[model samples]
Target chain A: MSKHRLLAMFKGFDDSLPVLRDIKAGGCAGVSIDDVDYLSPIEHPDIDEILERKVNVQKFTFTGAVFGVTFGFFFLASAQASFLVQPQGGKAVVPFPTNFVLMYEMLIFFGIWTTVFSFLFLAGLLRKRGTLYSEKLTVDQCGIMLEVDEHKLKSVKEYFKKQKSIEIREEAVT
Target chain B: MEIKDKIIDENLGWQRINEDVIRSMDAPGKYYWITFAVCIAMVLCAVAAEIYQYRMGMGTVGLNNPHMWDMYIATFVFWIGMSHAGTLLSAILHIIHAQWRKPIYRFAEAMTTFSLMTAGFFPMIHLGRVWNLYWVLPYVSDRGIWPNFRSPLVWDAFAISTYLSASALFLVIGMIPDMAILRDHAKGWRRKAYGILALGWRGDDRQWRVFRKTYMLMACFLIPLAVSVHSIVSSDFAMSIMPGWHVTTFPPYFVAGALYSGCAAIMTLFIILRYFFRMEEYMTLNIMEKTCKLTFAIAMVWSYLNIIEFASTWYGHNTYDKELLINKANGPYAHIFWLMLFCGSVAPFALAFQKLRRHMPTMFAVSLILQLGMFVERWMIVAPTLSMAHNPHQWDVLYGSIIEWAIVFGSFGWFSLLFLVFVKLFPSVSMYEVKELTFHLKHEMEEEKEAAATSSKSKAGAVGKPGLEGA
Candidate 1:
């Protein structure tokens, strides 16, 4: 089946939101919007509704932190316990208070690494580049890319037109 | 015009901000090369000094038995303390949603990362056999020898490394969106460099949502981590059984002093960047004024702690503590002590006046003085306490060698060099956050105007009614 993708650009968030909503409603009428993605120079409040889609990045962060704490404790304790304990000044081999410091540091270190890993995973960063990208999206312009049926192309273009899209481009997907 | 409206006018739009920031990276002027060359030269000099010290041993650098922790450790503390204000300011201000932080937080966070890098060097240099530095790492080895987790030095390693990693991550993550922006605008090798660094950021809502969440998580982690890192550094001295070093108030005292010095360093760099980058509109007087005010407040906190330290020492009636406190004021290092007081405590008072805060040259001079005072303050904290320890027989007055001074100067050049490279590469001012602030201000102004228009129309309608006008 052939697909039509419509890309619209706007000057700012305020200019873009109404157009985005109109396109969503218009897609519901006929084209059945397959996917919608926004590209902008900066984050916007209007983007929140789209971003609220469930993401599991924070779960990995929590798991990494817990592992960090447990591993930090075990590493510090085992190193001290297994070593040739000189028993300095009658101090315990694996002191708790001092070891807590290392534990705290490890928690943060592992937590941060895991967070970055999760970010990479969930955000699909460092992946094979996608074709639908515009350099202007990084500057003053905001872009909305929509996937729809080829048969509904005329109506979708008219829908974006009614919303007064600053610019539009249509591409055919195989 | 209202202050907010004026700020909007000065900053303009996303396009203008991008142009202003990216222009700095476009070409290397003669001044840029000159500054870069000077930093390289300073770094080379420091490398030579380190080589000399390595060859001759620890004795070559004014480190006697009593003053073993002289300039290197002092400078380490200073840098560590200097690292504090950036993360503290950036994280805390961000958490609180301070709009002014939008313009300065990028460099401030960069300062935290680079200063920590410089700080990491001192412990390595202070080691007798720097090659054996890996022994500090916690791992099971064939020899079964492990680092004592209980040692504050080990804690120092952990704290500094953790702080460095987190700050560096924070700095890099913060730069990603900006890097994506650079990737779009750049050409040739620069474009490839930014593209790789940007990690295919398309500024999609999903990527941004995750990025913001991760950034916020890091900020939350950074604040407590930053505070704890310095507190751990303080424990390096305070955990010692030494008289002056064993104060109960050391943690808060050290934290306050770190913030004080760090804020001063920020002001010093803020003005320099503003002047050099021609970021007058973004790095406006309003931000500097707020910075000065914060510095003054921190100075006051540090001073109050300083007084409490003295008072507690005197009142506790421990001969060694009292003697050390007295010696700090009037003994061998008296000049250094008083200089610290003058610079750290007294000079910040000038900032309390709005006029001084607004004047760039005066504020810069004051910041420099405050940093100098802070540098001396670190030295004072270490040297005097160790020199005038309980054993008078071991007491000796020692000065930092020329080699030590060279290394100290080198650290400054190293930090500046990194920062200069950063400015040349990335947007030193956060392009997106600044644009966000401008947008909010513009929106607010429109709202206010609309409200005024509606209110005025209602007033006009009321005035048209005879009973209302008479009443």
Candidate 2:
């Protein structure tokens, strides 16, 4: 009984083409690669790098500016809110100075919110399709594999005989 | 044969474990019974205190105007702060790839759940008429007025509920497989209990797929909840107009303090679990040391904020803010103020050194001290400022009466008592994650050596053994 069962673990990838090549070579046996898993780590070294690489630096800064502007708006609104009552103030009653504290907080809060969410989104956690591979990949091993015609089995086996930890098996349908 | 030569050694070769290390159920001879009786008695005491508080109204707990939320608020904040250590250690550490955090995380999460339960009681009980507490929420009201969305109290309610739900979900999702493992290993009632909790989890591919997805989603959800919960708590104070209470920095500052105190509380519990549950093998020096580093860093942040807030008050020339700062530092409560600095600042800062951090007993002591100091910090925030208000004529000295003190003591007693019972009920260390980490670490180490050896062997040989080499 022979059914293609192959496991490959690669260290680094220069491009998705090599991975795509490996997957094509495997021909749908059982392909698992941690390349996407390590993408965040491999791409951004730290928080600063995360901010820099995604071209979100300007966006993140702009959000901070917007946060300050909104805080000012809230400050004026709340202050002017009291002005609507009896004994209307002669001049503006907005607490601009005290409101700066709120502005600072909103900026930091939004900063952390953006950074944390972006990390999750970048990791492909936001829109995960059915995982690219199966559950056994987590525990046993990870690789790309091909389920080929019985006639091609011997050739495929021979091809990967040189690589480390390569195995092939097949089974006929009942 | 001569008598000396004929004599055989008959020593039992027993290892000496710290008395604190032994589980309450498994205490050495008489101490076992002693610890069990004590823990049971403490649990009983807490239940009795709760009953008394319920029957006589919360006034029995010495809560009154000006000091409306004294010991309970302090304790609630303390317990909630303590809960942070577990989730932070679990989810954040998981994201950051710290293998050592796994063993400590399971119990720490349990601590979080129980402490949250205990923390929850305060808000309910603090509402003197606990029966009417449901009105605190928004419902299709007969009064036609929804609970004020603007009120920080409502936000606190929403935040705490969300946090508890999320934490419970997080803890349950993480524990399901482990519970299944327990189901397999257990017998009778334990087996049935674990089996139910396991929810027919059989480690199948489909089950794993869902489990992994749910776990990832929960973690993503929890990270924000963790930040949001503390921020909401801070909002309760910041929303107020009291000089010391109103500040934008409270949210982040409170979160930092919560994390700082939470880390220390976790350390205390971690060290206790390590010793008491015979978990030194699983918990280990590496885990404690990593926690020590986090606690030290967070403590520095907390101290920096404390100074900055004081500096801002002094610099801004806000008369009320300046007076509150002065009263906090040098007025009637100066002793606790300095003690807070000593425990939260100086003691933990010593952990900056690697050697001191590695010393288990020292780390344990420092952690306990910092947790106590955090309790005092919450007290200093709530009590002294109210006692020394802007309207000097209305200022009154607030002292915690005996009943208030009892509730505080009884809550700690409740926490410890619950913790001890949990240790007896379940394995405190996460067996699966720990085993997985150990396997990964060993495999990684072996892979390094094998890579070196393979390079050398490749020149001399043609084939390599594959299956077990990597496994």
Candidate 3:
């Protein structure tokens, strides 16, 4: 089994800020932002620095594009070179301009595909449900999800209460 | 009113935007059923036409000699061009942070993907043996003969497939948050479907941060990809050394025309979605005005390029090019050439008038006219070039047989079919983005109200005691 998770809901983004802040200052039992998950009706980019830091996914896009270019160059060049039995007119066996076009397309193709895959992986999507969910969190409410040890569940519930969270769901993941 | 005030009506809250868009996804009513039936009937007609054409071969479509590329290729080009507007709105405007594109961008992006799907059909329809389509793909075969990468047609294969993959990913990625909303509110099978599609999106900070970055990166790749896609499409004509088809200016000209036609399509769909979905608050007159202004600008650019091509051909004293241009004006296709000019160049002047542009009915009519003009322009490009391609012995005035006509008209039905199904299955508007727009607009409104209150208080205070009352 996994750890116990606390799901706290507030009316709006602003209402959820202080609890996120207060909990950060007070700290949990070896819990940090990595163990914390947020749910909301909409995007809230503003969060206490201690609670969450923006994740980077651009490196995957760059690596994907580089790989695409290298693969495209090798694949297209070798195909052209293999067919040197009958050269078409005076044209070079492997022309740069023609191969470059496909290479450019490949870069964008791989760049977007890699970016999307990395985003899905890093964001913890397409997996078994790990956090307790509430429909209202998607509708009009803001949610803060924090994971902690089993013994510390009561004190975290108190933290949610201190901030006047409208609804809270406590669940143990296995 | 300033467009800032009009982006989202003050009366709308986040919940209203969510519920209203979700309500739009409810089993569509009688009119939707009627339109859907009509689209199906048209597609059936097209399917029957394709079957007949397949059995009887290319002769049925009047594809002979130099006239091998006719209505199918032209319509393919037209649909491919049509896909550009979505990229303009969804990717370019997104990168630039054009907030006005928010409400209308979802449908426009959907248009990009659907039009590309529709456009992709033409090459297959044009092919004599459709089953050999895999010959275009690079794979290990015992024969060892690869597709000619030297050909622009092969470049097209690469560009279109990459374009299709990138735009489809962009559309689905952008829809994840909205899908999550639907998953929560949805019931039964729909809930499960959306649950899988949403990929367990909780709008967590990590998900959002990564989503924002991923979306922006795709947008960057998409803009150049869009330009390259159309430019490569133009190369199918421009790379050919046949008189009028050989113009150096063809790439930019085609790009301009693509944007022009796409913006018009967006206008037509914007009105339909607004009226059908009852999305007045979200779609808004101001966005329509901005769209009209953009379309008009692109139309003018297209017109200018048309003139430049004519002038360069005339001034360069290339007898072949000049004669084709003249024959286009005076030959059997003269009526179409002039109508293309009138619809593509002249009719767009109506958009310059603010009164006509903002009124939905007039804009709808104008958008349809522009589409007609763009369609005919494609016809003009293919027919005139073939008829006047340098060799007098080979010249022939080709008229499309009924099979060709059915396939051409059927494409519109095919597109409408995909779109109708998509609108019901998906939220045509972005829910979370609208919430963000409403959030910003609310703050801007509050600031404006506070400023107004302060100004009024100062005026009232001055009126009771000071001499400069009304000032």
iRMS values for every prediction: 1.2, 12.0, 1.2
**How do all models score by TM-score?**
0.96, 0.69, 0.94
Candidates 1 onward: DockQ, in order: 0.74, 0.04, 0.72
Q: Indicate which candidate wins on DockQ.
A: 1
- Candidate 2 CAPRI level: incorrect
Instruction: Write the residue-wise lDDT of candidate 2 on A1-174 in tens digits.
Output: 444433333322222225434544553243333211221101112222212223233344356447645964674355345544434346444545434433444443444344334433332332423222332222223333335455656665555453432333333422
Native contact recovery (fnat) for each candidate is 0.72, 0.00, 0.80
| TM-score of the first chain alone, every candidate | 0.85, 0.43, 0.88
How is the predicted docking of candidate 1 categorized under the CAPRI scheme? medium
For residue A58, model 2's alpha carbon misses the true position, in angstroms, by: 28
Q: What pairs collide in candidate 1? A: none
TM-score rank order: 1, 3, 2
- Which structure among the candidates has the greatest TM-score? 1
Off by over 4 Å in 3: A1-3, A25-34, A48-52, B1-5, B449-471
Question: Candidate 3 on B1-471: residue-level lDDT in tens?
Answer: 365548667557777888999999998899999999999888988899999999999998889888889999999999999999997568989898888898989999999999999999999999979998888877645688888888899999999999998888999999999999999889999999998899888887778878888889999999999999999999999999888889899999999999999999999999999999999888998889999999999999999999999999999898998999999999889999999999999999999998897789999999999999999999998988887787899988876889988887788999999999999999999988888877777777789889999999987888788666645
Model 3, A1-174: lDDT tens digits are 357878889998878877667656754445565667777766666763655575668899999999999999999998998779876798998989998999999999899899999999989888787658888877778888877778778877876787789988988866
Residue A18, model 2: lDDT of: 51
Q: State the displacement of the C-alpha of residue B270, model 1, in Å, after optimal TM-score superposition.
A: 1.2
The structural similarity of chain B in model 2 to the true chain B, as TM-score, is: 0.87
> In DockQ, how does model 1 score against the reference complex?
0.74
lDDT of candidate 1 at residue B32, scale 0 to 100: 89
